[model samples]
Target: MRYSLAIMAIALGIGGAQAQVSPPLQVQEIGSFHVGGRVVALGDMPKREIIPSPGAPPIQMDPNGEFQVEQMYAQYIKLAEPRARYPLLLWHGGGLTGVTWETTPDGRPGWQIYFLRQGHDVYVSDAMERGRSGWARFPEIFASEPVFRSIGEGWDLFRVGPQSGWNPKAAQRRAFADTRFPLAAWDAFARQSVPRWTTTDSQIQAAYNEYVQKVCPCVIIVHSQGGNFAFNAALAAPDKVRAVIAIEPSGTPSAGTDASPLRGVPHLVVWGDHFADSPFWQKIRNNVERWAGAIRDMGGTADIMDLPADGLRGNSHMMMMDTNSDEVAGRIQAWMARRGLMR
Candidate 1:
């Protein structure tokens, strides 16, 4: 059954001080697990002496031990009366953790709760080297150093505002005139961005594929850099992945790759506004477009939801956290219903 906007509104009253979901959304179970990683033993590594913490005794650490690395972390909520046949896996973008689907920066319930109230079991994940999935020793287990995203880079690259409009002071920052992102919580959102590694895509992909094999016959909801992982996961196991919903995905499979395996899987590519302003996003969009076109050409159900063109305007790359996030999620829910994803 489809849920009403009232259910989502009930979730809006969720925050730190006010953590209540009226007529509380029922759930049978909530759990988490670590998936997909290999144990690597580093031989011929040097030993180092370092303090474990402030005012602590120095300990000699041997950097030549076997360690587990590159595993992904996932937490799930199984509704007592789920309305969907399969769980919904929420995958975050680069430099982000599963927190993307949790509470918003503005202190509102995020897509995790929204979809939960909509009657689907939800699984939120922290990709390898992110959040609960700890990082490994660089230049050993990992290929290179990690890259961090600065507030200004996020502000500009995320389309929250132009590069010239960003100011250290929140009051001085100028957002897109019609932006729906809550500017007051920009710093809070930045806190969610973690250090991301450019060279770990292969590891991340392997972990995500393992995750899919572990818990699927499910739909995948991906954002930004996760697009590549989601597409590859589905391609690797189309039988397990029922559908994919990508929001402002920054990358995709090579348009030349055979997409016939996904001809049976439904795909929804959602885009926000202001593509003309960023050449980088334009290139990304065109690439995804070509890939989606390829899927459709192979007799697959590949749909596009251009928010602005659909009359839902003022959205940015972080549309899931925008002021109108619930509305966007509602649109996605409606599409899922049309695709017969709901029970």
Candidate 2:
């Protein structure tokens, strides 16, 4: 699927240093739906006057009513001709939506389109309280306030650069010499960060479990916080989860949890570079590694793809958005093929 420039130019009947263009995607059907939510009923609450928009008149709002909350939203693309045996489900990390798999911060097509072009029907989702999935009231339905991520916090936490290297000016900002992330799009990436709740993990897991039940006998590709949900979802419904590809997963189940459920499942954990530079990421990696080890102990297929070790270095935590994202994706595609998940 790697298109050389000469071949592309010949195919398009053009020549001489032109930018490469992707072929049109062949899709059978495209649709979306909202899944996994419960209704919350309230009573005896006071009505309040609130403005619905800027320069708008205030209206009386009813506080006591039945409300739907904690639901997850999902959109899917089914290819005209699929090469994979089952559909692929993509789950995003914390503070992000299905947008994580759709487009890169630099405006490049992301893994959603990449995998579809690879001939897999793909389902991209917005976890509960994210994106089009909508959010619940804080301290009431959500039980906690939403927490937002700062740009500098992401720069440091995502291993894009050292904390000291971050500057308000992109020109003044310093990044790891070998970093693959698109530094110029750092601010645009920050716009993708949403306000995440600390206490919503259980609700998120529940919704993910329901989602698996709804759209699977499938493989799932998860990143960061979505890793925990994907792992637990497989444990909850082993028959439905064909395989798991976790790219820089931020968390995992406790190492002691019985992983026998995954004995028949294949798992791949992909890591980018610069783990040694962040103690926080180092701890996260160890925790996920221990969980993978536990799965191996249970006779499951749990493999690690350390990009640096594979000589695919300079990837940030957001490898899917990195410059060489397609290369990283090709690696995952190969792993899936080796696992016999691909046709």
Q: What lDDT would each prediction earn against the true structure?
A: 0.92, 0.92
Global lDDT for candidate 1?
0.92
Worst 10 residues of 1 by lDDT: 13-22
Stretches off by above 4 angstroms in model 2 are 1-18, 50-58
56-162: candidate 2 lDDT, tens digit per residue: 99999999899999888999999989999999999999999999998899988899999999989999999999899999997889989998888878888889899
List TM-score per model, in order: 0.92, 0.94
Native-to-model Cα distance after best TM-score fit, residue 102 in candidate 1, in Å: 0.6
The TM-score, computed over Cα atoms with residue i paired to residue i, of candidate 1 is 0.92
Where model 1 places Cα greater than 4 Å from the true spot, the runs are 1-21, 49-59
Predicted structure 2, TM vs. truth: 0.94
User: What C-alpha root-mean-square deviation, in Å, does candidate 2 show against the real structure?
Assistant: 3.0
Residue 228 accuracy (lDDT) in model 2: 95
